[model samples]
Target: MTVDDIDQELLRLLSADGRRTFSEMAGEVGLSVAAVKRRVDRLREIGVITGFTVKVDHTKLGWGIEAFTELRYAGATPVSAIITSAFAVPEVQAVYAIAGDPDALVHLRVRDIRHLQQAIDRMRRTGPVVGTKTLMVLGSWNRDDPAPGPVSDER
Candidate 1:
């Protein structure tokens, strides 16, 4: 898709609140509920709108430890193998294959530091078992700051 101004506005509204009703969005975007629905459907069909999900407080869920681990593997060790190993451990939230000294970066959220260590040990044994470096997060401000304004003059 080729998104226009109205489509952008509709997206902005839905992003702020995914469960927002089509009727309410129609009122804000100056379109009928059915028209708005069509546009949203098209967005999903084209893969612009993937899925909706709830944001949770990890601390409240008893998951206190958060860390970033840089992993290096011996030459010829497939990245896919490393990713599969990490995925087997539930604490591994995301895995990024980078283009630097460390071949991959893994994001983890676990019950505690000991839990994190256990996960790391498992992954180390599963993959090429070359080396690893981990940095535990003291704190984070993932959504504390107000986002900046638009870059272009589109608005």
Candidate 2:
């Protein structure tokens, strides 16, 4: 699906706030509400727009501790299975099959250090997990650049 200017505009507005009504999006994108709806449906059908979700504040929810765990597997273990098992745990936010020394990397959110330790213990028992290195996130700094504009002057 080739997204034109209007489609891109609709995506930008929707990405920032998915709750925006089709009428409101139409006004912003200078298209009819029906047109906007059609484009949105097309985007979904083509797998451009996945799903809309609310961003929860983990700190407010009493899950203040964030940690990244690097896991190394013992000889020739299936890393995908390990990642799937780790993600099955509620505390695990994200999992990645990585290269280099570590076989997988897991991002976790927990209530505290004790909770993190318990989760780690469960993960170690899952399979051929050889070792794990954990790094506690003390604070997070916003480092993402602004989203790309409609067209680039450099191009």
Query: Can you write out model 2's per-residue Cα lDDT over 1-155, one digit (the tens) per residue?
Result: 59898888888888777899999999888889999999999999999999897767799989999999988888887766877778767889998988778988999999999999999998888878899999999766442224555754565
Against the true structure, candidate 2 reaches a TM-score of: 0.83
All candidates: TM-score? 0.82, 0.83
Q: Report the poorest 10 consecutive residues by lDDT, candidate 2.
A: 140-149
The 10 consecutive residues of candidate 1 with the worst lDDT sum are 142-151
User: Which regions of candidate 1 deviate over 4 angstroms?
Assistant: 139-155
> Candidate 1: TM-score?
0.82
Cα lDDT tens digits for candidate 1, 63-111: 9889999899989667788788778878889998877779889999999
Q: Which prediction has the highest TM-score against the true structure?
A: 2
Query: Highest lDDT among the candidates is held by which one?
Result: 2
RMSD over all Cα atoms, model 2: 6.6
Model 2 clash pairs? none
